[model samples]
Target chain A: MLQNFIFNYIDCPGIQSKNAGKVSTCAGCPNQSVCSLSSTKLANPEIVLVHKRLSLVKYKIIILSGKGGVGKSTITSLISRTIASENENKNVAILDIDICGPSQPRVLGALGEQVHQSASGWSPVYIEDNLSLMSIGFLLNNSSDAIIWRGPKKNGIIKQFLSEVDWGSLDYLILDTPPGTSDEHMSAATYLKEADITGAIIVTTPQEVALIDVRKEIDFCKKVNIPILGLIENMNIFICPKCKNSAEIFPALTGGAKQMSEDLNVELLGCLPLDPLLARCCDEGKNALIEIPNSPAILILKTIVQSNNFQLYIFLFSVSSLYKFNNINYLKLYQEYF
Target chain B: MLESVKHVFLVLSGKGGVGKSTVSSQVALALKESGFKVGLLDIDLCGPSIPYLLDLEVEDVHQSSEGWVPVFADSEQKLAVMSIGFLLKNRNDSIVWRGPKKTSMIKQFLTDVVWQDIDYLIIDTPPGTSDEHITVMENLRNVKCDGAIVITTPQAVSVDDVLKEITFCRKTGIPIVGIVENMSGFVCPSCSECTNIFSSNGGVSLSEMVNVPFITKVPIDPTIGKLELRGHSILKMYPDSEMSKAFSKIVLEITKSKEA
Candidate 1:
């Protein structure tokens, strides 16, 4: 594990690596010349700094989906808000690592907010005294401007978000990632590799198309050694508001998440049906519990937070990689998630 | 080299899983059924859902003297398809490449694919701004493209992300063909009543705000969601359904806008 560690940073062989420059991975890598050198490996200052910052964070949970628009950001917002409101004493923060399309700022209703750099680092924008957020949205001049960058540039910001963001100290830090297991996912996994990442909550819509990506995302988590906390199937059914006739908006031709979860051996945390009022809350950036008091989706979200898997895993997480949703920091996870 | 492609447009969205592939597949099929030689480029390399949606998942691309021969959806070869999903060793073998590999793959798909003499090329991208978007924009900079068909659901978050997508298109020089509000509502088959289950009209307001054409609002059509109809294009499969009609209208708007 130690030998394979460091994600070889940018898939490079690192400075002084025996396979540097000559390996197929370095074919187009710009740092081939610099990385090909043979010498004693100097400890990366950035990794050391990131470790320093994240050490203060008790529980680190990343929200991921191999597919887009599966409600990862929405779930992150709902869970974080619920946790912050419920556990007033604990600190909770969200790190939006979706460089191209950061959703946390808007989802948390802090879209136009700015990040302030203190002597410590960039202070996260506060939503509540206990809950704050750090997203690229706050840095953009206009929320609508495209962050048209390639992999390396995106990785740079993600690193900044991790090492530079001043969360002070957080009981929970939920990182929201964009769709696909590419640069952003790689960057997050690499930086947070040794950050004692709690586990990831995988979000997906109940359908074969979305499930296909969910499977790949699961594969990614396993490859990166990030424990799979559980799988969340969002928008499972749509009940007509008038007739109350429920229909699968996205038909599970291939058995959807239930079959996939069973096959992948990952926990199926809870299923949230598609509700219009809840959708309205996400769009309006309002708390679903407050806005749609009787919403069924809220009921499911509650179940997921209280789900024994989520609670039980926090404690067992660091003990063994054999388990999923493992070693959850129950108190902190309860503070950040519940 | 894409002299065969007369007009190239992209199926883009700010958020993922909002049916960018669904729209791209149906629109490509609609154009093909209308007798236009269409090419569908699935540049959403990582999550290449187009092959599965279009039921061409089993088809494989072959190398030809012209370049890579695209798999045809129909027997007549009117609809040509290229995607990273096709090059996979197996069905579940995900493309685990980072930005560089994905960027190079998109470039290869653009330059190596032999979409000889196509009327319209629809590039279906993965949601959000990334290397795939940049590579496609840089490569297609010289090509004559009709612009992009931006898709979204009737939700605020999707609209928010799509605004960034619109800005991305503007900065990259791709014009906006229109905004499509997809998965807007659900129509119960038994009750025959419509419910704004996903909310409503987020795309229309977005179009108005961005000053792009308002294409069409496609409801959540369950008929098309059936597993058996996975590879069947909505236009030919459910030609009489409300969803099919919306797709046809979308095609009408695209052609109309291009002509104008």
Candidate 2:
């Protein structure tokens, strides 16, 4: 939409230019047809800039869930932490797009980290040597103060995050979106049109109620052409520490994530049991993936990250880099990480 | 917009998934069971869980000469239930609505729905004090709300957010009915043992600090969770359950305050 405005602002060559032998600048411009006011307009300049900025990132994986409080943010944190830990030298960034409820800053222990804006762009707060984050939470003066902006304003901030933030050459740009297939989701897909969106990972609780909504989230991804990497069932069960036995907290009383995935023909990524330690870790701003390395849920997340398609893509990326740089070290690095 | 309803109770919470919808559903059901004509409006635009919490199917809203007809729940009491969930064509079709669209939908839910004369209208709102809260408060400015019932768990994380909800209510001039600390303890299903899962007394201390009444602490009943997943209200299934009694007591406190 912004592209049309920029396209129209360019002065169009009139009939005089047509008669003359001179070639107008508009004639050579890639967006000439769009500038001519054709219905099939050119890509918005802002979106193009967003794509250029995001193309530096290897994968843009969005964490989405239709139901709120379904652990989307936790999954985003877990995945990023796991990847950043494994690929120690690789750059990883998380763009917390949950404008209304930006939990990433506090969850990552980067709360109150001021975002520094330079001539290039806004610099994301580094949570680790290789991992950084950008969130609306950092922009707010007070954590308690609510962001009451409407759809347009929220979209603008998301756009600014995509185009303005200098996330230089990230291996993974994990986008933690708000619940529901609403404004934030739409903006992410629209603005990151040219970015390599590896796909979406839909998170849900192991309850029929949450599964129903998560099914819609998967459907939304299909409609928007954002491939669903898989469905994750969070709070699948509660394991009693004393008895060492698993208990059903919010189970699939009436056809949960497993059944829902079967019915919808989507892959069930894994079920994460309700771990009290994990909750405590998140509340205390600790990394569960690192703190609880043997966590069954974290193991499952690692498996999802090492799926065939993801591995193949990473392999190909390393191979390509090796060829481009005429170096074998990149391949060795990838092999070592894998 | 809701002249026929004598009282309005806007149930809210600052944190999501703290059983605000559950409280709203049970409170409405308890009031209806108490022989009051009730209408439950699920105004949670993005995640409309009232229908699911009540085990409602994807039913269509019929239009009559009066207005859009609220769905009649198959219950003994006269209860009118409406939710944005019902308007969806498919279960997985997400409502990608924005602020203006959500505001208009809320306006329609308030103005266009034919909620017949009722003793109480229980409005279920989404979590947080954002656009939805502001819209509901502004729209119901002329139609006075009896008060708002804030729901929260016993975790400091949740209580922190609920405190914001209390502050928002104070600033907006909405009367604070009380705060209900839900999921205060886990009532062991196998053994009747109570365990403080997320810590206790967070809600009570918060209410004391804010000078508002602490309504009741609803323990995390595993049966209640299962029943909700199965789309059945624990009140109707297990009327004498502790959770049901807690909801009934909260409803009594709300109605009694109205009489006072």
Candidate 3:
């Protein structure tokens, strides 16, 4: 549909010359090495276009993990749900950059809906009244079909999702990166540099092995200059069916969530207990937040949202208060540190 | 003169428990010994091991008017070293900085640190092409360097997974200077016959296939492990050891290729 829409109105040469030519022309050009514009365009065309449209949106948050089966998608879905639920009018878009394992659509229950392309760009499938969603799963002919793509091919498709899609205005664009800090994560980070990422939220289990790999992910974020928002411990505990009581399935031996946050000085967002109902809802393509109402998991999600909102409020308050005081020294210090 | 500095070599690997830190440390020492004023920056935020490997402690890092001074090797070669380990109060204390904070710190290390009069800045990255590796590539690109060195073992799985890191460097336009096969073969205690326990020659094959130079093979030695456990480097423990000789040879190859 996006391809069809582009073909109908805009000539390929014109749009290509504006964006694509800047990228292709850089090839073998002496200025290619230091060319930020060309590299940014080639890395992520969608993010570049989005920047032009909405200059107000400051940061893009990407949630990533190393090993699969670590509940990264679940954490992504919860974060998006939390952000949209708390902020009434703020527009939030969940872009699933995980082409192979496109679970955001299923987790958020936006499957079977096709992303429509308009004259401006491609529109994301609405998850709720406020939240918009786009995923490779939504565009797939069959949900179970294997993508079987190499790095470059996958990078191109992700670019198309970002550029061709009409995201309009957004306060936050949370990207659900494929497990492992591999090709997709690199491409997303490089392309979305202009978005000035707030930071990444790393999701992991409480096991030692998982923590080991998760540490690497955390270190990776640090190395790349992506501020770490925090760590979310998924399946921190499990509730007993017979007694309806919570028990720590995997003992928090490493104090993983606390230690990681303390060591990294990032926020430990919150932890979610293992719930059968939540898992079933995700499998059945239902919203986990809606299915498990008044649940501990939902409570945790609410708390994280509140904390993030509180942090933002403090940030804005400090800036405005500084203006009122008109203290040049404090202003200079704030500018330097922040 | 500063703008003329090209090729930042960051040594990295995916599989941990491998001697990635040691390889990176030795590379810096060798390069410095070879007359290149190298800045050995340890970007492993969580586990900053370079300081310990080089026998430098937190107290040794002095603050001068220029900036926080790097811990130097005893030799006149003057290998400038910066690490998170040096900044901490205790060597065992954990780094509690979050993602954004860590990124900022790395940027500070690159831009803020007074790394003047250096030809090669060898960045010793943490294992895996995670955020840390990306940060090095991103920040160093701002500095504009020559390439990177990917360190791996002779194991089949290591060779396979390390290629992912190689591909990452290539994607970012960081040239592959070469790959070093660390812990390639084990020497028998009795006969001293080299045994292919993890399958030797895998590194050579992988380098040839990847079309990068097979720098050299470093044999596994118990003495090196003992030295490491004691927080000593091979260059110090056994200056005339085979492993040290191999490292020196690799450094020569790297410098030659860079000049070429």
Candidate 4:
């Protein structure tokens, strides 16, 4: 069923598909399987396998906020649904790195679904036809249970999510990070150094208090050389339905989303208006994108997806080199054999 | 030559829950009382409790064309204070800054703010030698530094860590004036005898081993906790308290050492 879905939905170029089969030999190769293929040999076979593995995957864009209650996970879900809906062929994967606040599964309404794992690796539970979902919440015995882990333990779990999880041929992998520039963000950023970070999307409210800290998060990403793709202002404005007019729920202060992006030299992606229904959908474990399709929050995500296409393309091409392999022409071989 | 401005002294500890901030605040307050212009800068970005300790309100942060101005607790005290906690919208709001942001803010707090012609600036640094600590140490190196006071408890772990902290200061060319042992001993609630709760004399022994001056041991007192919980600095709350007396002695030692 999964293979049929992949074949029908994912558009695999013929040359790439042929090359992938040639690189599949590394699955049986002992050295390439255990250690990184880079350590074993510089041969085309190793390169092909590595490339194939990476190409079959997509660029992982992790949205991280320096602190909590910043609506980071909600933004993650919005981006996932938006990108998935925009590109029908692309498989959008959402991995919630907030082990303690595992809300992705719940937000996507995939809570209580068992994450199936085998000798191969752990597989993400499907949210929709095009979106695959995984979170620390899914593997737990109980969803409400807390994850009491130190830095090293969290790092190990993150590693498993990246290398061990069977995220086959993804277009974009969105990781929703827990708040604070602490253990989780550091671990994810450091571990996935090689993975093309389509970039970080910093979420902040219009209030000076949130911006002060959000500015810090922006500076951190800059220091680490992680491209600040954009700054998103969540809860920028509120519109009253009866009045048919929009009002600034939080008073617009200086050094807000626009000022911050200008000062920091990052793109101001867009702002999300204050929508109670959008919040309610998230609270009710429904996709905010589907629940509030006509909402401005969805519009902002759609714009980000459109603007970040160039980056997404470059990320995909870079990972494509990992899968190229030499193959003998079977038709010619068959004629020669005959 | 006439001294234009008194040098800044930053008191830091290598571990948490060591009363480093408490000591720095009191020392600053004491210097203010001694007729010197003093400024207390709290660089503990995440857990900034300086405002609460000094009993200053948020509206006290005066702003000018120059930038945000530090607040003053008392006119006679003449102490200018600034904390990230004060800049925050709410008191309980957590500061979730990355290393670079913390560094930037620290730099701004030092250079951008209109500190005026202050005599002594006592900086309270967060525990551990993380990026924030490094930023304070590095920036202060460029500035005029009088000396640094290393604080610790009478426990071996804290003593060992503080010695390494002292070594760090020494390596960075920051002069170590002295060491103060906080919670050195617990004064009996019933009897007048002092109990060696954390094993007394560790501060003296460590100071002797490191060849730095052993300032004084601030005994554990129930009133200290009460005053602290009330966001009151010990110097302001209990002017004649034993801890205040010990801190004043240390301040005297620092001034005498600097003069020499």
lDDT per residue for candidate 2 within A153-264, as digits (tens), equals 8889999999999887788889998777677888898776456466677888977667766777777777776666567888887666655556676757867888887777
Question: Candidate 1: where are CA atoms >4 Å away?
Answer: A1-40, A319-338, B257-260
Give the alpha-carbon lDDT of every model.
0.83, 0.77, 0.65, 0.66
Off by over 4 Å in 3: A1-47, A308-310, A313-338, B1-260
* Residue pair clashes in candidate 4: A51-A322, A51-A323, A52-A322, A52-A323, A56-A169, A66-A180, A67-A180
Candidate 3: residue A160 lDDT (0-100): 75
Q: Could you tell which candidate, 1 or 4, scores higher by TM-score?
A: 1
Q: Write the per-residue lDDT of candidate 4 for residues B1-260, one digit (tens) a residue.
A: 00334687888766454678678777887777777888888887765657766767454566789777888767654788888877877653555455667778888887766677777888897655555666777787667787888888765535644665676677668888888988776444434455554556778988998898888989866465343333444666677879878887878976786677
Each candidate's DockQ: 0.69, 0.41, 0.02, 0.03
Docking tier of model 2: it is acceptable
- Model 2 misplaced regions, further than 4 Å: A1-40, A306-338, B75-77, B191-196, B199-201, B208-211, B227-233
The candidate with the higher lDDT, 2 or 4, is 2
- What is the per-residue lDDT of model 1 for residues B193-260, given as tens digits with 9 covering 90 to 100? 88886678889999999899898899888777676776666778777888888998989987886678
TM-score for each predicted model, relative to the true structure: 0.90, 0.86, 0.48, 0.49
Candidate 3, residues A1-338, lDDT tens digits: the string is: 56554443343333324444345444444444444344433534466674565455544677876544456766777777777877878888888887655667767776678877789877889988878888886776754344545556777787777666777778877788765555677667766655555557788777543565577677666656565556788877765554555544445555757776676565566788866566556655577677777778778767876774435523432332233332122323555877
Candidate No. with top DockQ: 1
Every candidate's TM-score, chain A alone: 0.83, 0.80, 0.76, 0.74
